[model samples]
Target: MEAKKNPRVDIYRLKNVFFNFGLMISISVVFAVFQYKTYENATVLDLGSLNKTTNEIIEIPPTTQPPPPPPKIQLPKIIEVANEELILEDLDLKLDIEMNEDTKIEQVTFEEDLETEPPEEEADKIFMIVEQDAAPVGGIKAFYAYVGDQLTDNYPTAAARMNIEGVVYIQFVVEKDGSITQVQAVKGIGGGCDELAIEVVKNSPKWNPAKQRGRAVRSRKVIPIRFILRQK
Candidate 1:
């Protein structure tokens, strides 16, 4: 017995069957895949509709710096004065019982301006207006009389007895009213002769008054008195 003949191979039917299976698998895979469209079933938010449609590319403005603030007002500078040392007050001194009770301390201030003037001269007038007083010629005479009366009895035994001739110079002031006030011996001779001479003039009468500027004024005068004792 011969080996059973192998079943007849249907190559065309096998090819047809494989082709149909591939086609069905491709269709099934395509259907199984998810399909999405961005425009499908879009939800529309309601906004107010306008008659015109516009698209604008707006240019943003650049930021600008504001002008610098006005320069700060400059006030004039004030200068401060320097401190000065305090001056102490002088003590109030009172030697007597009389003094002020309410004396207050005071500030010492000095002025910068002062002027000096020239001295004045008055040839006819004295330094101050002082009137002349009458000289005491009467008193001088009384003094002389007293001396003369005393000397008349005592001259012989006096210590001034001399033989030489001598002159005595005396200065006297004659007041404006024809009176003598002061008398002095400007020159004298040794011994009591000078005293005797002065005694004589002091006892003399009042003199005529001198005049200055045509007006009777007191004046100074010098007189010489002589005293001689004879030699025995």
Candidate 2:
């Protein structure tokens, strides 16, 4: 016979042990009992409507409106005519058609006040393009030569530094008395050339006055002068 181990030891030595089966069965039974007790004794709310509702009744008074007035009816207009028997036939209806001799309308006359005003004297006018252009003592070429000479004397220092070169056209008026007036530059190239050109023209000698219709007249003129820089 094999030697027998201790009965307590043999009892505890299970070959295929179900270690947690007892604990699991106990837990499952407790959980099922808890669920059943909860189902049996739970405080369930009916939540069913009691139908206890209060209705608010509002009484609206009838509108106190005034009745509309009746529509207006227009009656037709009637004209009365004179009766045949009541009409007057022999009654004397005379209209005096006579002129009064005392009503006299004399011929009316309006005497106007006569005013005599002295006439205004005619103004002497300056012409833009005269019938005959004004000239220098010589001619246009001579005039340009004179202007060139003047500009050469007073050549602008700035123009020389920048080597500026262009033509400067100047405008002025020749008076009827052979005098130059209102000199100004019409176009310019920069660098003090404009002023220099204007000064040269202003200092020029008087030109022969222009003629219009064979008579001496004041005239306006524009002349161009060249400003050239020569390289040595």
Global fold similarity of model 1 (TM-score): 0.33
96-131 per-residue lDDT for model 2 (tens digits): 756698777779988865674444323467788778
TM-score of each: 0.33, 0.46
lDDT of 1: 0.61
Model 2 lowest lDDT segment of ten: 116-125
After TM-score superposition, the amount by which residue 150's alpha carbon in candidate 1 deviates from its true location, in angstroms, is 12
Residue 127 lDDT in model 2?
A: 88
Please list the residue runs of candidate 1 whose C-alpha ends up more than 4 Å from where it truly belongs after superposition: 1-160
Show the colliding residue pairs in model 2: none
For model 1, state the Cα shift of residue 116 in Å.
Answer: 32
lDDT of 1 by residue, 1-232 (tens): 8866445664565788899999999988887774533557878888877789788989999999999999999999999989999875896867676448686668898865467433433433321122443333456466446545655544433444444456678887765566665678889865676666666556666765554434556667676655545445
State residue 113's C-alpha deviation in candidate 1, in Å.
Answer: 40
